[model samples]
Target: MAALDEIQTIVILMQENRSFDHMLGHLSLEGLLPDVDGLRQEDMELTTYANEYRNRFYWPFLIQDEASVIRDPPHSRHLVQVQMARSSSGKKFRMSGFVDSYIQYTQHQTEHPPPMGYFDSRGAWMTSFLARQYCVCDRWFTPLPSDTQPNRCMAFTGTTLIDDTDSRLIPHREHVFDWLNARGVRWRVYHDGPPFFLLFGRFHELVGMKYRPFSELAHDIQHEDPGQAPQVIFLEPRYFDFFWSDEPANCNHPLALVCHGERLLHRVYTALTCNPEKWARTLFIHTYDEHGGFFDHVPPLPIENPPPPGADFTEGFKTTGPRVPGLLVSPWVQPGKAFHGNLDHTSMLQLLAEKFGSGPEDYSASVNHRRAQRIRSLSEALADAPALRPIPTRAPEPCPPMPSMKRQPRAPNERAFQKAALELLQHEGPIATAAKYPDLVGAPLTP
Candidate 1:
């Protein structure tokens, strides 16, 4: 085993949506994802409680409630209702997609339906990511009943909801950052829009350990070339720009998501390779914040893990949800090994804390339950000194080069841009919109 003292840096990349099966189910099998399986699209499908037909398609083993079909929380009712409204009112798809349709459908708890484009075949991406990097804990899970915000907070702090009303509410629990500060480990979060502080306030000390917009990161990697990158870097995909998709862009947009993810990893690989002295000990991790309502056959058992309950939100908080997928890329991890050990969000935080010698109290400590097992460094996976492999580094792609920008244009005569836009949009279509305004662009152009 490589000595722990040899490790110096850790980098984390957390994307949105996608469950394990939705993204990695058939990965182990060749030509399976492309094969047909009756009405089941040869691919994975999200389960729903409202529809018996939909729920029947998932892994029967994972599901426990026969009548209460599993539906991804934050349902899609608002989305469907809005679409029906536009059809009868002789209106086009609304540009105010967030309020009218998209967000509502994505944010509610409804029955399972066919795989939305965003979730088409994320398994391909997950499999590829694991085969190319490292796979840990197949049973890894999320820590909340909600989506991105809460799950993300749990990841960083191993706690429950930050705010019952607003996910933006930052938790005060001591996190991995606290340990880093004491140990003098440096870090930062590269974003694309507002600083994380705006949404997370006082937690800035933890989040801001290193904070910069995605664009800023691009500039630094290409131009500034900071002699030393942050010890721990969190790279968030540019929401609309890099992860764009038509069907409300859930989590499955593998072409865009995987492409962007690979490109980003390539950069990290490059940074490490260019400066072997620094990269040799660095570890890069790429994973999802939560599974957007896609299908998963594996029923998630409620693990006894608890975060600093109510420490972030209401007192007595507990994690109640399913698993999310993750990829660990480093010399220390067993390359291409799929760890099927049962785990939850706290499990990951627990592993990281232990790897860096961060006290358990900083993470799993405040929580109550079976303490998650820490993952040991995977340095032995490499034959020689843990050096960054000489791999090709694809740089940050330009706007025009992005698949989202290459969407086919609407027919010249199509009215109600929504009709035109919706028609033009698909699972992996390009993201081309003449209309720059979010509201005006997607609304029906017709009267």
Candidate 2:
């Protein structure tokens, strides 16, 4: 194993709802890199049948310039089964039912479903640049076969006791923050708006002190005493809600334009790499929480350990969800390298446990045991890699003009994560005020 001392800071930026193939599968086609497990000519030409006309719909070639997707695909538990074409026996995943699932979800209203679409490297230049310059993991999957909240919970704590994305506060569970705190490992959550950590109320005090506005991140990087800087930093992109606000969401939710996200990646990369000394000692990771109902050809593997014996074992999380983009950025990584190891959200926890000793074993014994047996630590990627000087990166293109917001109903498929986020603000406190700025008092809650 490589010495943890080589890397001083670890930064994670998790965006929303994009599959690996959806975003970066065209890297090879674009001549960016040759060995990446990306889309092939046959893959691009595959078709799925829709019942409407018994029509054979050819998979659309990569869409390079579109900002927001035309339609949000359904990703709820029931829909995922349809998307994967999971057999009734639960032993086979045919990976052939996406188009049919989309049609059913939209009630056959949309003749063309966006889930069948993909993006070439041109659509996600920043991601491609990072993957080309560092390492791209093609086999990374989300921990659970569910939506945002549970998968995110798995990233934070080694379990998601809850199975679905219902609009409610997350139940208290052992979190990585508690582990880091016990071991004296410094960490911080930086956000452009409401930090997602607020969703887990158990760590409210920790979130309050460690959570800082994204604006302060650059300043902290430049001015803070090296010894005082946080060892682990999580950057939360601004999330889009129905409420009127000046900041356009950059989290890349299906409804928001992706250009904003590209600019965000630029901001984060520039700030972290500006200082050579800091850049050399830092390792930044970029990934998505889940595939967000996108089409992925590879079937997720089954895990030996499911969530403990009791909590929602009915739809056991034995198998990981669809593949999502995972990039490891650092001066140490070899350019154009692609790691094919099996990794999921808990792999991060495994890495943290290795770097800083695992904390409070009794906090969630079953979950911890399951994590130990299943998740693969990502530290292996850093092994035997020689550190190099920071490479210069081009400035991200300017964002497209903002689209007009219209009074509309809240997306029917909107994740409960967003609703819980807004609910976090209903409480009367300093945290509440900071989270719920530009009051949404007049805005219709459903819209």
Which segments of candidate 1 are over 4 A away from where they belong?
1-3, 31-51, 54-130, 161-168, 195-197, 203-209, 213-229, 240-274, 305-320, 358-364, 367-447
Among the numbered candidates, top TM-score falls to 2
- Residue-wise C-alpha lDDT for candidate 2, range 128-219, written one tens digit per residue: 88888888988898877778878888888777777777655676477888878988989988878766665676434533668787878888
Report the number of clashing residue pairs per model: 35, 0
- What local lDDT score does residue 258 receive in model 2, on the 0 to 100 scale? 70
What is the C-alpha RMSD, rounded to one decimal, of candidate 2?
3.5
Model 2 local distance difference test score: 0.71
Which residue pairs clash within candidate 2? none
Error of 1 at 104 (Å): 11
